[model samples]
Target: MNIEDIKQRITGFSNELYPFAHALIPEELQAQQLVIDGISFLFADKDCKTRLFDLLEVTEHEFVNKEFFDLKKVSIKVIYALAKKRFTQLESGLDINQFGVFYRLGLSARAALFLKYKFGFDADEVSEILSLSRIEVMTLTHESRSHMVDFIRPVQEGLQQ
Candidate 1:
């Protein structure tokens, strides 16, 4: 495809990928770079969603189980089963954004939440996008919501004070 065709094909996809990359990667420039890398793969990867998965696998991540805790322990209990690394999201520092919860989740969970919540994708679509079973997508979303409740409670209570 020509440059214009490629650009037209990937138009709205970069917008989605950048935020997802930003959620996984803290640095704005780094996130943009990653999305650009993903976009560059448009010629190779047939689908935008597939490119997203490729980006997810390649990004370096800190894998810590329950590593972030301040005054109270806000553990993503389900993560223990998955041995997923803990993360400190943009608002996980209690920065007060309602959607910050997505930043704390594992890759699958975060992607699932983003696709489902941000794109209005249903479980079936998310399962296809993330390459997970329907049940797995459901479970990941459940865990994401649970993690939100688990962490947000402490921040909310503190904020109310």
Candidate 2:
């Protein structure tokens, strides 16, 4: 695809990826740069789209256990997952955005959780993108959920009072 098409596709998912980038990188400029760099890297991969299509063509899969499927959603999720890693590597220090429980986890755990929950990717897809095992993704996702619940409990208790 042409650069414009690639840019357009990235922009289509900017709503989700931008916040993710911001959270991971801390500095606004570096985060934006990371996103740009990520897009470049993704386009450079060239075979990314082909790999995604190959995944779709599978009947008995090595990853996901679900029967339901959607190509558009999966495509977007795959892109987001890949970009999230690129953005994350731009982290230089602990000056991360401390606005969420996700920050409490390690980088990989946070990325896995964000891809699965915020970006709506399956555990298998997240594993493929992040290079983690399915079990690792599952564990991170569970931890993320638990952390969120723990973080919200105080607020919930106060509201009940």
Candidate 3:
């Protein structure tokens, strides 16, 4: 199939799999486009699919038995993660105008890291790994850490409530 056809299929599948995911995303337009772009990349390249599937497998394994958490909350957490990462990368970056896209990227990066460190998947195993360069990976790592810190602190504070 052509790239457009593959993107369409992937979009349809994503909507079905994560029906609430779109709404939870910060930037609607960018979020939608990212999904389309990811699918298009997967369709046009076999290696990309392998990497994506590898990451997916890792996510599934890590989250399989976890308690049910609000997807929206998770989405917010993911966005925060991405935003933090992007900001660090840009250092002098402005606020993310495309919240939806930012959230999606964060989610993707989180899933990728979870798979790599949490599930023992090597960086080379997953598809189109988010950080192909040292700088990108470092930025992502810092963002992910910040996201986690922000995410957990709230919960800790809530428990004292």
Candidate 4:
């Protein structure tokens, strides 16, 4: 493959990965660093795609096991996961925290919604990235909506009473 082709691929991947990494890690510098590392790794390996996938698998397992939750570590993990996948389309939405709806949700629920709604990833993609089952991703999405309802219900009740 042409070196230019590889550079283009890395750029596209960074766009797809950056928002999710920033959102999940809540540290912009750390998130950016991870993406940089991913790009560097991509350039260094001939079989970059496979290498990225292997890194993602390791990251996913660590996330699921709750073994690496530090912002920098999680940022690196998420970047590797994002690099491994290819997103065919690009979409945009406000950040999850910016929407003021996800603050009280659990991390899993927030990540599920962010990947699904914000990034337009399907159940399978989100499942792979987060190392959750499709069912788990679905459940997380549903629970996030439920949590939003719960958060708003009291205001509705107050207004009615």
Give the best candidate by TM-score. Answer: 2
| TM-score of model 4 vs. true structure | 0.58
Q: Which ranking of candidates, highest TM-score first? A: 2, 4, 1, 3
Model 2 per-residue lDDT tens digits across residues 49-120: 554344445556433223213333444344456546654565555544564566666656767776777768
lDDT of 2: 0.58
Clashing pairs in 2: none
Q: Report the C-alpha lDDT of model 3 over 66-91, residue by residue, as the tens digit.
A: 31122222232333344345445543
Query: What does candidate 1's lDDT look like per residue over 1-161, in tens digits?
Result: 23453345355456656666666555567567666655554445455335333443342333211111110011111221122233333334433244465555666777677768875778886776666799999999998888888876766556774
**Between prediction 2 and prediction 4, which has the larger lDDT?**
2
Q: Which stretches of candidate 4 lie over 4 Å from their true place?
A: 41-99
Residue-pair clash count for candidate 1:
1
Give candidate 4's whole-model lDDT: 0.58
Q: Mind giving the per-residue lDDT tens digits that candidate 4 earns over 77-133?
A: 456465333211111222445646664565566677877888677898778767889
After superposition on all CA atoms, what RMSD does each candidate show versus the true structure? 14.2, 7.3, 11.6, 11.7
